[model samples]
Target: MTDLIAELDPTQWYRDGRGPRYKQLHRHIRGLVSSGDLAAEDQLPSEREIADRAQISRVTVRKAIAELVADGLIEQRHGAGSFVRASSNRFEQSLSSLVSFTENLQARGITSASRVLLKGLFRPTPTEAMVLGLSPHHQVARINRLRSGDGVPMALEYSSLPEDVLPRPDKIDLSLYELLRARGTAPTRAIQRVIAVNATAPVADLLDLAEGAAVLQIERTAYLASGRPIEFTSGIYRSDIYDFVSELRLD
Candidate 1:
């Protein structure tokens, strides 16, 4: 008698697989993990028990579990059983509206913090020229940071602005917009572009995502009241965590 039970879903891959039982089982479990039906830290059924239930050899179950572990989807402790890996959750702000990260998190009842990644004077590269409408000879201030809310990393932001705009990039605090306003450089409006992308190696490392995970990329060119570009920057956000919310009014 088969001791193991499966939620029989006809649409699941294993139902018509052309492989051995072990291979079929492996694919089935992975599908569940990817779909989030089996969540992180949720214990997988014991190998011995599952083998007995599925009427398969224990070696088959072990082979399947080994592959999942290698992919970082499951982990096995010395004594404890295997468990699914949990990915991070996310929060998102809009590219259409003007707001600070601190303010946005506060509105959501979550605390926000910043860890500065890069702060220095940078001469504009060719890419910056196209984005900011600046000459290659122009110098800008660069700031890279990991912005988090309620202690979870949300987005990786890299911004560049004319050096004359900030005066001292190192002295700036959490709210860049607030500082700009204090210095009489209010960014009245901005033009932004949005794209969906897969996180690169460095981004994945900082955002704690599995390599090549989906993310949203937003690039903005903020303008001063005089219609002069004040800042040009981009942000990468986790796809699972953030869903940009926008409201449209009919004319």
Candidate 2:
């Protein structure tokens, strides 16, 4: 681990430059882990050791380690220091594009499948009613699916659509977006918000994670070309098996 840290290019550590030193270290260490230099379950050097070698303060090392822990890249033990996390079913997703789970997995050459947990018309929650623009008297199709990639459970999706837009729940299966396209109500754009949440017991069981594990929660409202909202969904993805990435460019 010490040798691997030393192997990182010195030019990349701009401790006195624009960004914070800990961020620089975080990026460098993350690269090492992603590149296989630091294999899964490998113990990282102590904070003091890293600080002494890198000529930085222990504070910086601690901050960088905290960020990596939150990202699910490293797990810190009470007395054993930090170890690289092992995830055989990890996936990275781009936030720049609006695509269904099936489409995303297809692009990665992974098989996507869904186990329908619930599918039927149901009364909308207050939040769902507002997001889907449905009347209080109307019902919506509430569909819960356990999404899998390469036969491993990856996420639990709960989606709602105004009954007037979808009507028939029996015909919907696999890809909801595909079915929407056939109905001429496919979403061309969407507004989404993502946040980190602790997994509940039931959600943990469905996603094969331990209770209280970290999960990424995404709330999305999808709209058609006419600007009419077509779908509202809440998805809980296992952080250990998924990553959301976005690229930015300066003009």
Candidate 3:
């Protein structure tokens, strides 16, 4: 770990325009964790040791460590210093990209699979009708799937599409996006909202989490290039195992 810390070039920190020293340090350490150089439960160097070695004040180290702890990447134990939080099950996902669960896991070299919980044409729920721009008489293909990575259940997803768009759920095999593309009704963009909720018994069981455990509830509507709503989806993800990230630019 010391060698890993020493490997960070101080000059690289300055290249970001000498911002808050603590912020720089925070980014540095977080980068190490994100890059897999620091595994979960690995102890961080002592504040004084890090300060002395990096030629920074202990105050800076403390501030940076505090931010890390707040971000759930680090945990502090009274009398035991700090340690990296377990992230083997955790995945950091980008909000800016319109990607499927399969694509997301594939990028990280993890096998992705799904178990179909429910599928077929069905009457639209009130909310689904409103979101999918469906008429009262229109039916929808509702697909409920339990998505997994490396054979470990990760999320429960419920998706509804106008029957006109996806007339048959039997056509889908691995990825919904792939099937949509094959049908030439693929979504080019999406709008999503995320909230924290306690897992219900069924959802918890599907994700292998305890009942009432914190989970991330995501609601998404995907659109075609012509701005037509094609799919509306809701998913519950294990909070202990996932991180959603959105990057911003000042300019």
Q: Could you give the C-alpha RMSD of every candidate to the true structure, in order shown?
A: 9.7, 12.5, 14.1
The prediction achieving the highest lDDT against the true structure is 3
* lDDT, residue 131, candidate 3: 94
**CA lDDT of every candidate:** 0.74, 0.80, 0.82
User: Model 3, 1-251: lDDT tens per residue?
Assistant: 44655744465342344357787677667656755678888999899887877678899889989988976789999999999988544699998888899999999999999999999999898999999999888999999999998877789999999999999997788899988888899999999999989877577557754345578999999999999999999999876668999999999
Stretches off by above 4 angstroms in model 1 are 1-92
Error of 1 at 155 (Å): 0.4
Higher-lDDT candidate among 1 and 2? 2
What is the TM-score of each predicted model, taking all chains together? 0.66, 0.66, 0.66
Tens-place lDDT digits, model 1, residues 74-184? 788879888777653345567568997878888889888899999988888887776667787878889999988767667999999888887689987798888988889
What is the lDDT, from 0 to 100, of the residue 99 in candidate 2?
Answer: 86
Model 1 residue 67 distance off true place after TM-score fit, in angstroms: 21
